[model samples]
Target: MESLVIPVLILLIVGAAVLLVARAVGRRTAGATGAAAKTSRGTPSGDPVETAKAAAAKLTEDQHRRLYALIAQGQAMAAIKLYYEASGEGLRASRDAVGALAAHPQPFRSAAPKVPEHDDDDAPERFPYRYRAIASKGDVTREVSSNMLNDEIYGRIRTLARSGDTEAAATALTRHSDISMKQAREFIALLDD
Candidate 1:
């Protein structure tokens, strides 16, 4: 009976220690998650516009949209590079800012600078210009050449590519061209870069 009592006490002590450890670990994890959530949501971080300005002071309205688009497409590295170049910030700061921006998107403060007044709304400039985009992987090569696609339009398409919405991007590409979905997919596949 005495031996039983000692063994039982030891078991209780071990169980109590385990419970204490688990509770401590849980509290630590919970605190960390809270901080992460706060960071991602931009609540504890303060006003989003200020954050955007501080992180990317030189980002024009169009650049801002394209950057966010890249983030949406899950092109973290490209987004970071774009931010870094646009903001003139170091790589690390750009990375952290990009991470936060991707987690919580911020709208463009003002209207996207009006598309230059065009005689035709669908077409920009006085005359529609033909632009060519080529993507090559292994031995397979794809080219998308269309007068309907300008830098701004292609930027939109590339943004869709970065955000991992190749289908939407492909659809947009086809809409801009006479190509079939298969050709659009082939072209969009090269656009991932």
Candidate 2:
């Protein structure tokens, strides 16, 4: 009996030590898994809006439009798949990005700058392709086409017209197009909206 007591006590001590070690290991594993799960779930470390914007920047204009349309239609899985194919990212990454994009609606921002760095406001740049500006009022329709009149220039002309600067807008329109000042004024008058 005395010999059995010593062995039993040693056995109990070893079992307790083993239990403690196992618990320590389990805690460490649980902590690691918890952190990994958080990251895998697409938890953003920074501003969610900025994160969403960054994800949106990866997509092209068409992709952006389709993704948003899918999101708007409440087709999350389709949106994710579209993003996955369009972005060529891992499935997990695409899922996260799509989730972020869905949570925060973002406007499509073009990869290239809208305005040129050395753009001269005084001298309108001529584009390779001719841009056509059309205006309709009731039964009458007018059109102005010119290589120097892109969307930006037309937008400025419209802005000037809307801001009660019809003369300036007409002048700008004449400068950019082959239309006469009287014709430019007539075109500017139709751009009420």
Candidate 3:
């Protein structure tokens, strides 16, 4: 029994270390990109990891899960609203939270297109917005005017985005941005930017 004790202690220590590292990796990888991540950043000087972890910890389970889903779809406002609704504790607090959500809105990625990296220095020309779609269906074949990138549609898109319903937002934007893959990405850029 005494001889086995050392190995048992070693096993416990290894398990604890593995758990700690796993938690750290999970916190970072689980995060929503762009706006969701940025919104929780602790000032310019604060520790980003700490800030994000704190924010995630603060969220209730449902709001946290919804927030993760919504941020992916670029619906910052709706996510914020949902977060407030779920976590505000009571009626008056929740109502006040709604106003807070309206004022602050939700987060989104910036408007800049990610400039693709190159290996050889041939000086990459700025490629135009090429359409990118992993999948598409339904009546999204038609194109709409670009002017639909206005406030009203943006608000709708924000709501849709929070719900993780990009298709609906795309459909709405299609009423204004012409629904091609490039146009869809562009419309999202316009609204999110």
Identify the leading candidate in terms of lDDT: 2
Best by TM-score: 2
> What TM-score fits each model?
0.35, 0.42, 0.22
Look at candidate 3 and give me any clashing residue pairs.
75-162, 76-106, 77-106, 131-182, 143-178, 144-178
Q: Comparing 2 and 3 by TM-score, which wins? A: 2
Model 3's TM-score against the true structure: 0.22
Candidate 1, clashing residue pairs? 72-163, 73-162, 73-163, 73-164
- What 10-residue stretch in candidate 1 is worst by lDDT? 118-127
Model 3 stretches astray by more than 4 angstroms: 1-45, 86-193
For model 1, how does the per-residue alpha-carbon lDDT over 5-113 read when each residue is reduced to its tens digit? 9899999999999999999999999988877644332434444445655554456788888898898788888999898888776676677777767666666665447
| Ordered list by lDDT, greatest first | 2, 1, 3
Deviating ranges (above 4 Å) for candidate 2? 1-4, 31-54, 107-193
Model 2 C-alpha lDDT versus the unseen true structure: 0.85
Count backbone overlaps in model 2: 0
In candidate 2, position 112 carries an lDDT of: 84
